[model samples]
Target: MATITSASLPRPATRGEAKLFAEFRAFWRAFVAKAFNPYRPELHYMRGPGPAWRAKHVGLSPAVQSMLAEIRTGKARRSSPSA
Candidate 1:
């Protein structure tokens, strides 16, 4: 492994070289933006805080919640000898 220093890095001294580096930096930023949402064309430039599906879902939809309610009843059925 080698360490890179700012003094050893190449700096754009000419207008043409500086313009090339600026375009490359812009392209790299856009590439990273698309990588997160490659499929959403409408969301190419706008990203939300979270996934839309999670807005009203938790993998425990109403039906699952109803099915899990029996656990409470089972606990109620096991009293401490009515004491």
Candidate 2:
């Protein structure tokens, strides 16, 4: 580690230096907001893996939905009453 000394420290800032520092800070804030940020679109519904996986299976055909409902009610009907 480097040793710290009083002589290595920066001199106190004058009024002009202080004003320039403030202006640079303001410019950086505005610049980063427009240029350095990622583009994230808004989602009206749930996001991420769980929601995505659930959504894929949740959209079932009418026939499939009816079959599922019947199975749940202990009345699953096999087409043609297989032998």
Candidate 3:
């Protein structure tokens, strides 16, 4: 018996990517439900982030902090040109 191996065996999806995909699917389902039932509580939930989400990642690298400040004050439109 001979064993064969291909040069390009597809890489398995990482756990993080799979989890993200699951979250995205849930969001999609919620969105569709909201579309058909505008007054549903889940509709409001799916609308997006609350204060907690914003507050969780408040700390950032100095470079990122500066860039965020620039954006907040309208000095930049994301992604520094030099970078």
Candidate 4:
């Protein structure tokens, strides 16, 4: 078996090398965080009716239009039979 020697052991990093390593480590951590992020803004956003939907549902029946208007005016209420 070969004898271990102090000279053959790894030397401690110098100040500059330590700083560079710290910066690189920080950069790598940030890159990994961004790469693995799961919070998609598009998925969380509240999507409204698009132009195609508007085009497809161009004509609303009078009852539905009145109900929608009531909802828009905050006058629509849930109907529950009185106990």
Candidate 5:
């Protein structure tokens, strides 16, 4: 499982402030994609595996993290594979 360092945590946004948060999340996701995706033709179409792996390993929140870990590690309550 991936570790959750403070540096990886996104800055907290207010309850209704969507603009900055949305942009930040988008930027973060893009950054993650570029970082994890292999810079080649074959892996080009497999962008989602990074996000899926993230959702399964380094989730956005603790609850999500736990759920993702369960799915990734295939515990008793394994979640169905996501497309």
Candidate 6:
């Protein structure tokens, strides 16, 4: 086995080098956090209905379609009985 020498050993970093390393570490951490972010807005968002839904609902009657349109447009009032 070869003997370990002082010259071959790793030296302690100076204050400036330590500060630079810390800054680099912080920057790398932030970069990784942003790059590997798990929160996907598109995945969680509601995109209304898809083509399959539209195809399935294509046979809706005109009266039902009109009622749905009214409800969607907020023109259909609640038919609650007055107390």
Spell out the clash pairs found in candidate 6.
none
lDDT of 5 by residue, 1-83 (tens): 99876656788778668887888899999999998986778755754556667768873878878888777788533565566
Q: Report the number of clashing residue pairs per model.
A: 0, 0, 0, 0, 0, 0
Candidate 1 wrongly placed segments (more than 4 Å): 1-12, 38-83
Deviation (Å) of 46 in candidate 3: 27
When superposed on Cα atoms, how far off is each prediction in RMSD?
16.4, 11.4, 27.3, 12.2, 31.6, 12.8
Candidate 3, residues 5-83, lDDT tens digits: the string is: 8798889889999999999999999998878875756555776677798789566789999988877867554545755
Candidate closer to the true structure by lDDT (higher is better), 3 or 5: 3
Which pairs clash in the backbone of model 2?
Answer: none
| TM-score, candidate number 3 | 0.34
RMSD of 4: 12.2
For each candidate, what TM-score against the reference? 0.32, 0.34, 0.34, 0.46, 0.28, 0.41
**Model 3 misplaced stretches (Cα beyond 4 Å):** 1-7, 38-83
For model 3 the local lDDT of residue 7 reads 100
lDDT per residue for candidate 1 within 63-82, as digits (tens), equals 77786787776777795367
Q: If both were scored by lDDT, which would come out higher, candidate 4 or candidate 5?
A: 4
On residues 42-80, what C-alpha lDDT tens digit does candidate 2 reach at each position? 544545569768778778889999998888766545444
| Model 5 residue-pair collision total | 0
Question: Candidate 6 has what TM-score?
Answer: 0.41
lDDT of each: 0.76, 0.79, 0.81, 0.86, 0.77, 0.87
